[model samples]
Target: MSLNPPDLRPDLAPKMRLDAPRPGQPTIGMVSLGCPKALVDSERILTRLRAEGYAISPDYGGADAVIVNTCGFLDSAKAESLDAIGEALTENGRVIVTGCLGAEPEYITGAHPRVLAVTGPHQYEQVLDAVHAAVPPSPDPFIDLLPASGVSLTPRHFSYLKISEGCNHRCKFCIIPDMRGRLVSRPAHAIVREAEKLVANGVRELLVISQDTSAYGADIRFAEERGHRAHIDDLARDLGQLGAWVRLHYVYPYPRVRNLIPLMAEGLVLPYLDIPFQHAHPDTLKRMARPSAQTETLAEIAAWREICPDITLRSTFIVGYPGETEAEFQYLLDWMDAAQLDRVGCFQYENVAGARSNDLPGHVPEEVKQERWERFMAKAQAISEAKLAAKVGTRQDVIVDDIDADGIATCRTKADAPEIDGNLFIDEGTEGLAVGDIVTVEVDEAGEYDLWGRLPA
Candidate 1:
């Protein structure tokens, strides 16, 4: 999980008197590592700090202390976390290592004695206590650590709103469950309240995220307990009422999720869905412990089209799993062509410890895996261009996100998620444009993936 620092409070007085040294306070810097979920957690931490009256410095050198939000989901992730720790140690400021990596911080503090604290999920409950004790307290009280139903991040015009936490999926290639635990959802009331807060803060586009968004409410079974049936679709419906463009990510294409397509067709939710299909070949998927039959998978996609004809499906595929045959790769390519999916991300399979796929037989060599990835991506690029070309002359409601000094404006349509998907680029000369304002734009040109357009007068 990657983390971003909390949005500073506009109300902070900038100057403050000193309190008795409580621990780690006065000046603060945060480095969040991993995915967007982790980023949200760090944002919450920042919200607490801002409430307490601390000045947040973007640079570590300027702060009295720094916090590193670490990721340990995979070998590469662990290595990156270690590198972050090394960099933190060299700085003169006191350091605190937190997050999933804090699940095991002996690797860090064992080498760096200057580290002030090593904390994990359990430890985080007392974040202010630990930080305050680390340094002398200033006039600012520590920020509230209580869960907030509000956003305190930057006014980026768009933000990722994580509705649930952790994963219940046991895909052998994944370590998410080990790192984040089983599915636990924040209550629907909390989620809706947070959405309102975000919209009030000028976030016009919301990306709903979780390890498996479809599984929301399953563990709680709020549907059964309250004698009222509620599902992810219901959650989406409630969030949609907040009057913002809502989108979903990491949705496993389960039958239950198919039920939400109709909900999405109603126009408040974007027609876009990001489901990680992993691989199209049944045997490869089984080895990864995804356990879905090939026919069932295709049927779900077919159902999506039947429910929402204009649906823009985005998916990720893994190439060269253990025991993958050339024929299996061919089947994947053929499926892509047949499906003609709108947006696709393909990654060469990387082996991670504790994943069942690593123990499976017939692993493909590095060179062959790289070749397959290249071939599939080349085909996907052409498919993307053709799809974009089909949109020329069509108008889309794009929320203005940023305006460059050169006078060009960058924005996103309902079909596009922030940062990962394509964007609508408008000429700088557009009048009365501001970030967070929605405007209609007609596609005048297209490239391989992006749509070029002009704002309506």
Candidate 2:
């Protein structure tokens, strides 16, 4: 019965659930934090452990040791990661910390000196070494074979396909490039091969993710192998052929992105884009060292809509950044009104420890930042309400995500991404619908960020 909150923590990964461990298996628990990218890292580490005959425990009490995969994107996230590490340390007594926060080993050790070890993000071997030292793996070669799709932290229905690591952009508000380093894309064939295995293993959706999805192969010069190219457009086309829902995330608004619209229009991929247009004002964007082409972006949006009318545009924005004037904030509101983006998320800028924006002049007061956030969210909500209202009579194809005991089926349309966007709920006649089943429903009612639908006769 809950609608999508106005302030969704889109950066969070879906909660993890693991199968029971085999008898006498040395189990390790994982506390995955941060974005889906980090979640993928956790999955990789767990898969490697599983391959070596280690079991994944879902909780501290059941674990021999725990891995705290941390996020250090924002000050708040850092605090949360530290808190998670502390809790894991207390509950399990043995913890290995790895992730963006692990990049600052002294910071973690300063907070929790009891941690067994700390390894930076995606350092699988180091994490494994730490784990092997903490809890020796007992390989039951007859039973410890890894699954084809590996140890998925997410549900079997959908998987996050990280095409690349790190980012090249040095935005003032971000330290990702500093922490994760420059873009390093996976080979085209490797990604496609992974996707094929995921599909074969019952994954119905592929959430393509990266630090900057549009720049997937920039570092590799868009290399081609086995009939697949590392470029975003080519990759999307390749993934689309796998017969699963392909949703792209963290895409920058590059001119080349327009090429993907035709693929969406052709039903090759989901007609959805999750871009982060941090701010709309040119000055604000320039200060953030981001592209300040608001006018060009609006035109590109219009062009995209013309090509793929059903496309759902989802974007996140940062408000009240350093040097943001009230006029600049209002300009953003005006831009939102004109753009009429289908899905939106907003953040009130806060200084991360190493971000360049901290030294920028004219930092807005905390109260002003909160006030701007409220106003921005209000605008976004009103737009969302109207947009959902318009879909009241439309028939949408939704993938069932869950079915409650009361028989309410929670589903997401092509316009919706899992966990972040609005949902279409089927209140009755959900007897036959199971998780991952796609069905057509007639929208009967709508709220600010959700819809009530019924199975079509």
Candidate 3:
């Protein structure tokens, strides 16, 4: 087990599986980069393409054209996106670029002018048009039919449900608002309809994601449509009744978020919240132009626990932000000690192109940033170890993610989110355990980031 777990990379996309193309089928390869939000965009694009008779190619050699879904969240991510574009161009000469990076077409084209076209985030029509221009879709009416649930980059057991597009927050360190524009929520009935189809298609977990989940119907005024309200709490209640695990992510700790806790307590949704608490120090938050309510947040956490003791709080933080003093960093460390968050991810701040934080004064030196990151992770690892040790004697309902040929099963508890959180391993007595099966196991062993358990006799 890893003692000091690595910081979660929001840029990582889930592994995708594609079927082999039939004879003379138009095929497209996708290099989907960035977070689950972008992955959802890729899924939508591919679903549209599939409906138009395009087969998804797992590799460049098999594809007639390649689509590079880019991430421009950070400078490093921009570089990565450029590299992916270059690689796709090398492998498949026809390339279409889209995503956050595509918002700045010049930025993408400057490095790779050979790309056929570039479209911004969630521009399905533009992407489809680009694909059609590059690769004429030859849909055989009998073979080219869209699946009910659409093309999903995630496994069939779980899917990322994007509730809205863009964010209204102007956090100095973030450029998302500039790239993706403002919050635009889909209709409440429409979102529920999509979730219903996904559930019917065998998706057991629905990870609700957006730039700001709490702010979900504020732009739409929580408009009600056909028995569903556009509010986050109301949306959660509707999704919970769909007989699937509903996990909320990217939730800003607005006062209204308290309403979701009781839903978790009632088993209407998973008792997990993925909040991005960038820093704990008020001064640091002020510098970042984020909410500086560290004290009130602690109170909120306490209140949430009071309502649902079993709730798993997962948060991401940033250390070494511009002008972050040693005292400020220590304040964050002390806050972590008090929070005792069930799952924690910490990032050493990096400047992104066009981000307001890049202009902020007193940027922390690289050495200081690295040192602070190490210290922050050590504290987090200790907390994780102790918290996990407490669960050693308890029982957890885990969803089987994989069952190996050797019969060892890799599973995740309700507290764990796929690709970002810990896992529970079942090394023996694993007969008949299949992927997507939710089974209860006795927790017998604990480590810093994983647990080992077995089927109860």
Count of residue pairs whose backbone atoms collide, per candidate = 23, 0, 0
For all predicted structures, in order, the TM-scores are: 0.88, 0.98, 0.97
**Cα RMSDs, all models:** 6.2, 2.6, 2.5
Candidate 1 ranges beyond 4 A from true positions: 1-25, 109-114, 121-123, 141-154, 223-230
lDDT of each: 0.73, 0.90, 0.90
In candidate 3, where is summed lDDT lowest over 10 consecutive residues? Answer: 1-10
lDDT string for model 2 (184-281, tens) is 99998999999999999999999999999999888989999888898998999999999999999998999989999999999999999999998889
Clashing pairs in 2: none
Model 3: colliding residue pairs: none
Deviation of model 2 at 165, angstroms: 0.4
- Which segments of model 3 are wrong by more than 4 Å? 1-11
lDDT of 3 by residue, 163-200 (tens): 99998888999999998999999998999999999999
* Residue 339, model 2: Cα distance from true site in angstroms: 0.3
Error of 1 at 34 (Å): 1.8
What lDDT tens digits, residue by residue, belong to model 1 across residues 1-457?
1111111111011111122323454777777776677777777776666556565666666677877887765556667777777787787457878877776667667766577888874245556666677654455333533334332444456677877778877888787787678888877776777788878767787888887888887888855322223368887887787788899988887777777788778876888888888888887787888835565777778888898988998887878788889999999998888888888876676676566667878888888988898898888888999999999999988888778887789887777766556788998556678878898999999998788999755
